[model samples]
Target chain A: MEFSSKLLENAVNEISQLPGIGKRTALRLALHLLRQPKENTHGLSKALNQMVDDLKLCKSCHNISDTELCDICANPMRKTDVICVVEDIRDVMAIENTASHKGLYHVLGGKISPMDGVGPHDLNISSLVEKVKSGSVKELIFALSPTMEGDTTNFYIYKQIKEFEVETSTIARGISVGDELEYADEITLGRSILNRIPFENSLKL
Target chain B: MEFSSKLLENAVNEISQLPGIGKRTALRLALHLLRQPKENTHGLSKALNQMVDDLKLCKSCHNISDTELCDICANPMRKTDVICVVEDIRDVMAIENTASHKGLYHVLGGKISPMDGVGPHDLNISSLVEKVKSGSVKELIFALSPTMEGDTTNFYIYKQIKEFEVETSTIARGISVGDELEYADEITLGRSILNRIPFENSLKL
Candidate 1:
């Protein structure tokens, strides 16, 4: 009774399995697709099929690519000495969009999570270590989210590569960003206090 | 800069062409498909292709079906004497879900709209006329929404079939339903008054 046709129901079920989508949204999407022309639907189907067949992880950076190396890894202008490490390919894309950093990237595929049965061996940590051990890389920036799992992954990787001569650092965390002191979270306030910068030229601290 | 990957961009563009889906939503859907297992994406693609290849319009009622005749048209229990004309198959399913109507259906494919270049000939109006001329049907119900185009289509069809010796009627339209009288629009209030039912249970009015 919920859906008009079995095909619609099946499509909705498949769409609902995606991240951030539910049954209602899936149903809406299905109805929308059904209203489109057959040529458009054919194009959508072909595109989906092609993505499944053509997409593969780069051997070097573990980022999604059609070839052995991702675009970032193949780019000559990118700084090879400073490699930014991220949990997923989407994160790599996010940083790439900023256009501020001109460094190369190494996608971790996933972070180490003991509860989820994912460990250091499961991720591309060994490859990262090997990349650092080659003596070409100098600094490794950890651009991970401020979450418990992210912290755990960061500490795990940090411990593994501490013996190496490469410098390790994480993205700065504190009062983000045009935030008033009254609305700032306790952890952010505390971190900002602990890592306060010296006020020299303008206002006296 | 438009899209990171050519394959992903193609997929997002194709999905965005579907009705009611924008570029951002299409990207979300494409990314969702990318994250799914290969077999799941294959199934979705197969389903979409199958729908395009296997689906056909029924010769009898013009509803979508896998066979020459739709399931509803072939059903013996459904009353052939009453035929409900609708804009699309979705409307048929909407009425069928109510479980009140026992009649057949005729999908017009779309309503008449000169602005969109959709005319009387563009829709399955000829097929509907032929079905009416068969003399098996006694009543034709216009179950279209209260849109200007729907009204125009209904009037056109009514003019075509008025000469035929059959009962012709339309689904009631007035103040809908659970609406407070004070908040009713002037047009709806006027229509409600014109079509108001008598309080007395008289055998004949």
Candidate 2:
């Protein structure tokens, strides 16, 4: 769309560069910023600049943090021997909210997708293997998604640390608690049947 | 959603302050920005700041501009006496793209919405009236939306300038071009029928 002012055009162009935002949405957002207090824009700009400049990643888990080591890694209460492997910080947050795992997390940054030119080396795999090699980590849980890329990354990481004496397991796949069995996908339903656990085990949760 | 880093949380909060963006979308956008090169964030921040700091509005028409007068008002070839009154610059751009109107525009910024606590005094209506009182304007076309607030705004401006010698009109409302008659809403269909022009007059376009 044609913009009356070059400054407006530039702002919209930069905003639309974000994923899922189009030119129309960018225009709406730019206009919204224009209508708001100048301090609002300043705050947004300052926050964005500060984030890009000062944000750090945990040296141990590769999750985004404000310090060298993330809070989870620095905490003494959480189990350090059992590390949950996931794709990124979003997954880390999701798992943390559930409070189901008492161990630390190893954020791989992203899945190893050959289609996207992301290989094993592109992720945070070597450091995880290093943790296992140190003989401190007793168990590594593969908490990646069920996608092909997720499985590939899981297998690749398992192979790298297989020689080390460490227990490895994957998160269970099953029908959602409230979902109807008829609506479940065939693959998931079949897997749920094959991996069925004792009735008492379900009650433990 | 929980953010591990304060800087990340701040960025997401600021971004979510924009219209229609929620916390999850803001987090996604913040992470996407982090994945991009540092220069991209800098560029977006700089553009937003520059737009808010240096953008100007047209002295004559009140449309957004980079200078004292907007490009439309600055152009000597366009008719100066005919003014199309619109709610904002977006409408001006939309009408301009159609290549249907060659007159300049007077942006009212917004409509009169009592529910939203907006009144005529809150808009650029006074400046528009001042332009009409100057007697140079030969016509004023109301191009605001057909909403109740838009109608109230149009009526308010019309009462302010009815004594002037200028001709006044509103943009026609009808079934949109290429729209099926059966699918058209009752109000629009009824209005289209009531305001139908002669077949030969329609052919003139």
Please state the CAPRI-style docking class of candidate 2.
high
What residue runs in model 2 are displaced by over 4 Å at the alpha carbon?
A: none
Q: Rate the local accuracy (lDDT) of all candidates.
A: 0.81, 0.94
Candidate 1 differs from the real structure by a C-alpha RMSD in angstroms, to one decimal, of: 4.5
Clashing pairs in 2: none
lDDT of 2 by residue, B1-205 (tens): 7778999999999999998999999999999999999999999999999999899989989999999999999999899899999998899999999999888999989999999999888899998999999999999999999999999999999999999888999999999889999999999999999999999998998
> Best lDDT goes to which candidate?
2
Scored against the native two-chain complex, candidate 2 gets a DockQ of 0.89
- A164 in model 1: Cα distance from truth in Å? 3.4
Query: Residue B144 CA error for candidate 1 (Å)?
Result: 1.7
Each candidate: RMSD: 4.5, 1.1
- What TM-score would candidate 1 get against the native? 0.81
